[model samples]
Target: MTRSVYVTGIGRGDGRQVIELGVMELLTRHVDRVGVFRPLVHDDGPDRLFDLLRSRYRLTQPADSVYGMGYEAAGTLQAERGTDELVSHLVDRFHAVAREYDYVLVLGTDYADTNLPDELSLNARLANEFGASVLPVVAGRDQESESVRAEARNAYRAFDSMGCDVVAMVVNRVAPADREAVVERLAAHLPVPCYALPEDSSLSAPTVSQIVHTLGGEVLLGDDSGLARDARDFVFGGAMLPTFLKALTDGCLVVAPGDRADLIIGALAAHSAGAPPIAGVLLTLGERPGPDIMALAARLAPGTPVISVPGGSFPTAGELFAIEGKMSAASPRKAETALGLFERHVDTVELTKRISVLKSDRVTPMMFEHELIERSRSGRRRVVLPEGSEERVLRAADVLLRRDVCDLTLLGEEEAIRKRASDLSIDLGDAQIIDPQTAPVRERFAERYAELRAHKGVTQELAYDVVADVSYFGTLMVQEGLADGMVSGAVHSTAATIRPAFEVIKTKPDAQIVSSVFFMCLADRVLVYGDCAVNPDPNAEQLADIAIQSAATAAQFGVEPRIAMLSYSTGTSGSGADVDKVRKATELVRERRPDLLVEGPIQYDAAVDASVARTKLPESEVAGRATVLVFPDLNTGNNTYKAVQRSAGAVAVGPVLQGLRKPVNDLSRGALVQDIVNTVAITAIQAQGGTAQDAPSGR
Candidate 1:
């Protein structure tokens, strides 16, 4: 049976879309196939929430299959054909989606339309009819703490009285100071889990694009990323340039008469100077600046949105103030904000257990990424990023902090990191910043390094200078247990990132050599490719150790371990030194661990394709279903992983070093923000004991 979660709001202004999107994220983390169904929707062009989910979560369920009926139609049907008939039609449409997915996230009706007098009752009835456990959201936008608690209790009771399986209650849009009190009060009264999310001003602040849509304005400048900036405040221009400049604040939209080129130029110039980065400039009174002025404005603030509207300044101010920011496909940053807020406040593990979605048989790339984040959060550990000054690292740090995945210590000059983060408009909340040059801990780190390397070196002076380097500082931190792990190489070479680890952390007692694997996330599943970034060449014994470590690493993650030792030949079809090496490695693996599934001297096609396996090595269990592919050498492994990554569009998430004393990972120099985030999460998870679970059959 397909499990379903119905996210229903008690009334308007509840901001249930946050709850809905959060639930969708949690669902995708555990299951491969999750569906979204809106039982009732407004006739407003298109459903923004569903579009956001489809784009953000990469939903394959067609848009036509997601919605049952519009509000007007649903109301008409209920009035004419009775509630039972109306629900029956909706249930049929819902099951059509439910049957095709592992879990269905049913979006309950929005209370925007006033014609539906008993909207809560209708949502409850629909949830019951669809056999979904209810996750009700209550609005607390302007309510007192006691009032909000009362409403949450009443909402839960109302759903329970309706015979709906009320799984949790989410009190959203509450005042930030009142959030704790609201949750405490509700917890005492409610029978199920309760999550109270403090209202985020960003989620409510309008974007430049949203303001444009609201006023039917013309965009004279800006890119998509610029227009996505939140309009936190609206600053109307009427004074002199200097006087008006002082009124500017970060993310404020500058509003003025279109003829006021002085104000426009001043605002753009100030924005260019980064005194306070304004969202955009809004021109009103049915005018646009002259071409010369507009061209100068372009140079002053390139890619900053300069919008012109026909309405007068006063009316335009009203419309801009009324324009609320919405989470949609175009504004992904807001989705990240929503997910971050949701994850921080809610106990997702408990909620997911209550929702009771079955574990998926297939793990898609998105699922794997989601699981990495969730697992990191379960037992949070501190992972330091040595490349703290890098933009990608800062952005990834913002995401990690927002999602509350793991504690972070970024190594760099504190002032430089803060300035860079501010320039990027990234909020690095509570992330510890350490400057290796000025940090007081550097002295202690130097002493420790000298003690550890005294056998090779003679003086503490050399160790002091060496520990000043960011990579060495980070590695020493890990060795001394100041931090759990470290992720670097975003702006450095792979050797610069991992060499300090080999020197200080060293390999585990049972391991002979350290190796690495890339979690090759294909379209449908994840595969582990070993020694892609570490070893250049290996003898039979070292190759066998790599395969064994790779298999253990694969099983540590959710990927099942069926070891594939790659060579130029399959079975006895061809013979070479390379084939002989792989053949011997396979025998060594089998001799050491008979419990592990092992195959070698196998061609790539035979290791992956069932038909090729049947022809080449019939009745071999590990021939075609290999999840852990151990290449004969680094030359083959590196090129193969990169080739597949480019041509097949796979997400290669590692060079995760196994057999280390503590968890430390390396990133590619061209790593994106998400790649860094995943690597950091992998480091944190590895720090949390990296235990292997029972292997399930691979997809």
Candidate 2:
């Protein structure tokens, strides 16, 4: 039978979606197939929670299957057929979905616009009838600590008194300072697990995209990515440009008359130079700057959003202030922050045990993504992005800071980076920004570089010039115990990005060469594809070393290594130099690490496809279930990964460089914001001893 969890709240403003999304994350982590059902929803618009859950988890269940009745229909059914019949009909619809999935997440109704009486009792009765464990959430925002504690206990009692299976209690949006006392008080009194989540403004802050959508504004310049930037505060720009620029805050939305061209250009210029990333420029009073001025603003901050609203500044400000940010599919960064916050505060082990759901063997993409963030945050590490001025890198840095995933240092002109960040309205917080051209360590680093390259006849002058490059400077930072790791190549070539590391950081003692792997996140599992981004053609020895290194990388990220040495032929069925090289590599891996489960001279199909494995090499352990696939050469590996990525629509998360003394990875020139974030997280984990050698401390 499928286990069911009904996440409900006593009233409105409880922020219960956090609990719902958090529970969905936990369920997907343990089981492959999880379904969501909302007993009733508003017909005025799309269901935000359901949309987010479906899109984020890639749920295959049809939209119509997710809801039993809309609010209007449910009210009519209650008036005509009575409450019992209304619930009974909804119960049938819920069961239809429940029977088809291993676990069903039932979202309870929001108390908004529900004219029905005794809603709390109704939800409890419905949960009992559905035979689902109840998880009650209480809104603790703007409440005293004692009141928050009482409300939490009262919520639990309301569900328990109705004889509903109350599994846990969550008090959300409590003041950060009061969360500990609230959790302690609730846990002391409640029979079940109690979790208290502190108030996180990021979850509630409207993004520039959300503001634009809400206000029906026209996008004058910024692209969709910049539009998605979070607007943490709305600053009115009614003063002169100097005063206005001074008032600018991180992630703030600038509200001024469209005629204020000076303010507009100044804001965009400040953002371009990385003052603080503004959310966007909201022009008011039904007016707009002339094309000439608009052109200058666009040039100042290329893709930063410039929006025009017809309303006056005051009315627009009122509308924005009243607008409540929602959990939507469009704002995935907020969803991630919510998940991280929930995971940090809630005891999933206790909640899962209470729910008693069986674990599934498969790991979903959502699970893998969540696991990456969770692992990276366990022991935070410092990571430097050399191409800090790149749009994708700046956006990713915003996400990394908001999630508290790592300590970051952006290697660039501090003033320019801050201006860009301000224009984007992204708050870098304590993330250090350095100018490689003027850093105090430059001369010292140049001298050190000269000493290290003395055998190659490198002079101090040449070393000084090379150290001026951001990549070389960042690598020196790592070498000199300044940063933990580095992730570059958002705009730089791979050779340009990694050459500094190759010269200074170099490979570990145990590693014969440096290689790379892509964590191919498929629908039902995460597979490791190696040498896809590095090493052109490997002989047997280098191929074997790549296999070993790839296996270690797989294990570090929690994938058990079942190495498959890929070849055009399967198990000596064909003879050629390529197949022979793979055969030799397999033998060398066995000789080096006999305990590793390995199968070699295997065709691509046999390595991953069960039916093909049975037809080709049935008895081999690594034939069908290989988690790590080491290709014979880069030509085949790179092409195969790209093909699978494009055709199969998988998220390939690396070219994660392995065997470096310190964790330094490269990004694709076309990398998106999320790709940069993932690569940085990987780099941080690598720095945290996710690899063989522990990252040297103080670096």
Clashing pairs in 1: none
Query: Whose lDDT is greatest here?
Result: 1
lDDT tens digits by residue: candidate 2, 1-699 = 888999999999988888899899878877778999989888899888888988888889999999988888888889998999998998899899988999999999899998877889888988988899999999999999999988888888778889999988899999999999998888789888889999988888887888888999998888876887777888998887888899998778889899988898898877776675677899998798998998898888887899999999879988999877888998887887888788789887678788877766666666676667666877888898898887689889987876778899998888778766665556677999989899998999999999999999999999999999999999999999899999999899999999989999999998999999999988777899999998999899999999999998888888888999999889969998888999999999999999999999998899999999999999999999998999999999999999999999889999899988998999899999888888888888888884422111100
Query: Compared with the true structure, what per-residue lDDT tens digits does model 1 show for residues 313-384?
Result: 888877777788899988777888899899989988789899997777777788888888888888989999
Model 2 ranges with Cα > 4 A deviation: 208-231, 234-320, 349-352, 609-619, 690-699
Indicate which candidate wins on TM-score. Answer: 2
